[model samples]
Target: MSHIRLLVPLLITAGILIGGNGLQGTFISLRASQEGFSTSLIGLVGAGYNVGFAIGCIYVSRMLRAIGHIRTFSAMAAIAAASSLAMLLVIEPTFWFFMRLLAGLCFACLFATVESWLNASVTNANRARTLSLYRLVDLGSVTAAQYLIPGVGIGGFQLFAIISMALTLSLVPISLADRSSPAAPEAIRFNVRKLWNISPLATVGCIVVGLTNASFRSLGPIYGQEIGLSVTEIASFMSAGIIGGVVLQYPLGLYSDKLDRRVIILVATLGATLAALYLAIFAGGDEWRNLAGIFVFGAFAMPLYSLCSAHANDHAGDGEHALVSAGMLFFWSIGAIIGPLFASVMLDLFGPGALFTYTAVVMVAFMGYTGLRMSARPGVPTAARHGRFRSLLRTSAFFNKLAGDGKNGDQR
Candidate 1:
């Protein structure tokens, strides 16, 4: 019953978040197509959201510390709602960029607060189940939100207004939820150069994961549209990949924990390479095949970073998790910035197939490096040997980051 109560607020929050983000998979591409925006420009707009999101992550912790989580979350949602609604009035790409920036900032704070709250509420005993449930709600909400796109014409700004309203309403539950005082805000002190020195492989892994994931997020819709998938089908294709990631992450993480983390990463990269190759070579103009390939790619590629993060944590003490997380996010942002540019260039040079080719090559390189590392350190276990996958799930800072203390927050 208590879990049921907890889930009520979580579901509401997920609704708001999914409403805001899920449509992007189709909305951005559709909007660009309607406006006749250049492919490169569209890519820039998509990348801009990531840049804004990264910035928000970097700064939102301090904002919450100063004002408390409830106020911070409410303000963020309000801002995001306003910005989203504002999109209806302003159709200019440059104007939309600023709006996306606002949305990104607000979304970051909202997610961070909610995730922290979820983390604080969870105990070690039930963390994995709780986190898994949280992720399920998140994935389900987003997938469902995708279905909303077909009802509202992509050109109508009314859809965005509705999304904004959802975000506004999401603030109510968190604002009124009964909870204890929030934790003291942790300071983020990132030393990227120092991180690189400490774990070069982990650092590189962060970059690769960021690049691959961001490209998938920003450009996948465009690719879908290019291949002649309808908006609804495109949504399903993108959602399927995310669903696969949510399902596969823990199992893969558990397996990585038992062996050298690098080997798991290598295997994942290889799998991603194969999936990408299949998509590039054989899935041409076939929607179902492309979707399947994407799902497989996501299963292998999306979780590799979490595994790398766990591996990095294994080498650090408890105090260093925040630092590592921050560093990883930062590197991920850098990669996110580069990923779109490279993907765009490839799209221009070789068409939609270039997306898969570019990603596959990167994975191949990472796999090669991991193999070399294994050769040098043949038998060392990079992570603990335990089937504590369920237990470890509860320990995730990612969930905490999402449900920090906000009404509608979930982070990855």
Candidate 2:
């Protein structure tokens, strides 16, 4: 009970920070459109964030080790808040891009700091409950934050101020709390070759999700605006996707545990590809059709990461779970950095519809790749499979530990 009490401040801080960041992401896309930024330029701006995120994932642990979680969170939160405000002040494309880059770095570190603390504080007995609560906070905060764009009217300094305030306020609970800080997280080192050897399918799956999901989130608002949806509708569109993601996690997880995970991944990829194709070709400007299409897309697409993680861990030997998680994330980051830039170019050349057209193409490619891999390799037998399915948030490597990665040989 006392340990859980210590986690309250961290969860509160995560909710505030994640909500602020989520709103800012969607708003940035909408605002960039209002400013008449080209699709290509906006894509570059979006990619900038991932680049900084990738860098932070690798280096922030060093800072954490030296200064510890509280100080690291404090410094990063201050910088993130400043960067949020800076974006409001400077309307130039170049300036906004740099600010987003800085924001990404700060957010990666911030999430890492909080997740490490949570990881350290929980016992294996209660880890699943704690992780579930944390995930609930993460999903609820992000989903609710989408509505704020329409609520605040996304136009002036006011919305930006709100975002900055939320980020800055995130610092207060942790700083004021009387709890001790956790041990600093170890620095992440990538051995891409080893990860590939463990499970090529999971490695590729992470990259594929990074490409398709990141593109959709970064540019989906623009897609809504281009298709004539109002701000309220756009909010619903985004939230529907997130909610749909939650809907399928447990069901798919149960099946993945019984059957081969590859089969699940293949089916999910096919579903996502079909949904994207439907959105690209038939959904058109209709609101309900777009909403339904995106909902199905999210349902099938979102769980692929978790399935992949489970599949990889099945093959990973003892002591390899953390390495697998970190490596997969690093690969995903690489895909994220490249995904937006390519998708943006497609959106520019083709149309708003090209957004999903881009995703559909990518999904189709992955589906084919999954087929080839399935042909080559046999899955771990059901009894031999190590872990159960857990829904994941791509916040940080330490977050994976909260799922209790190797103990009892359960899947993280």
Candidate 3:
């Protein structure tokens, strides 16, 4: 009860920020297509955001250490809100690209601040429950915010204003709350080779997910728009995928804990590959068919990160989970930085269907890689597994700590 009360302000702040972000991401893609921006240009804008995000993850902890969490969050939130409105004022693709970069940096810092604070507040006993509540807020806010696109209509400046308003309002909760800020997190260090050696399958899994899932999130709305989906249906299309993501998280998570984690990873990649193939080859412009195919794709796709993270942790040494988690995210960001541009070019050269076709190809490659790794190495013994399965969001490194044993965090 005490924890819930203490967490209310942070949760409220997270919900507001996530809602605005979710709406902004989909809205930007749709708006860029509406403005007749080239598919390549739209993809470049998306890549710019991921690049900024990677940079933020590298430096934001230093800012948190120097200034403290409240000041850091407040500063980033203000900048993010301004950036949202900036895009409204300047509709040029070049301007949007830099603005999105700024927005991504701000959001990364904001989430890092909030998540570090949340980790500071919880004890080991209640950590899992606290994380579950946080995930619920994340899922609800992101899914509900998708509807704002159709509700507000996408062609004008109103949606941007609303996004700015939501971001600005996010500040109210953290600023007004009486809670003290947590201690600063360690600076992110990307020892990529070390991580790959620890768990090759997990490293590759994060990369594959970043390639496929990030591309879909950034460009799927463009796909719908090109195929003649109404604004409402586009919103539904995105929402169905997000909602379907929740359906399989726990189920697959439970199974992964018992079986060889690689087996589960292979199964998931196979499912996502087949679903993407269906969308690319069979779904066409039929609303229900596309919705169903995307739903299945999301179901198998979204949980890969958590699965990968768990697998990596299974192999991490003592006091190394936090480091491994941060490394995995860094790899994911690398793929995200490149995926949208590649997928967008495919869309331009081929058609709307090429978006999913691109994802199918990536997933198929990942599935084959998973099989090869399985043949080369053995799974972690069940008794030696470090932690139970916990669903994850690719928000910040601190997020993984909330589900960890708490020792690694203390060691840091």
CA lDDT, every prediction? 0.70, 0.87, 0.89
Name the 10 consecutive residues with the lowest summed lDDT in model 2: 403-412
lDDT of 1: 0.70
Summarize candidate 3's per-residue lDDT along 1-412 as a digit string, tens digits. Answer: 7878878899999999888889999999989888889999999999888888888888888899999998998899999999989988888999999999999899889989989999898887777678888989998999899999988898889998999999989989888998777888777667878898999989988988889899998999999988889999999999989988889999999999899988888898899989999999999999999999999999999999989988998888886777787888878888899999999999999999999999988988998888898889988998988877778889998988886658765222
TM-score of each: 0.89, 0.97, 0.97
lDDT of 1 at 102: 77
lDDT of 3: 0.89
Compared with the true structure, what per-residue lDDT tens digits does model 2 show for residues 133-252? 898888899999999888889778888899889988998998888888877766667788899999999999999999999898889998888888999999999988888888888899
For candidate 3, list the clashing residue pairs, or say none: none
* 10 residues in a row with least lDDT, candidate 3: 403-412
Candidate 1 lDDT tens digits, 155-227? 7676776787788888777656666547746667777777776567778887898778778877887777788
lDDT of 2 at 14: 91
Rank the candidate models, highest lDDT first.
3, 2, 1
What lDDT is reached at residue 17 by model 2?
84
| Candidate 2: Cα lDDT at 203 | 95
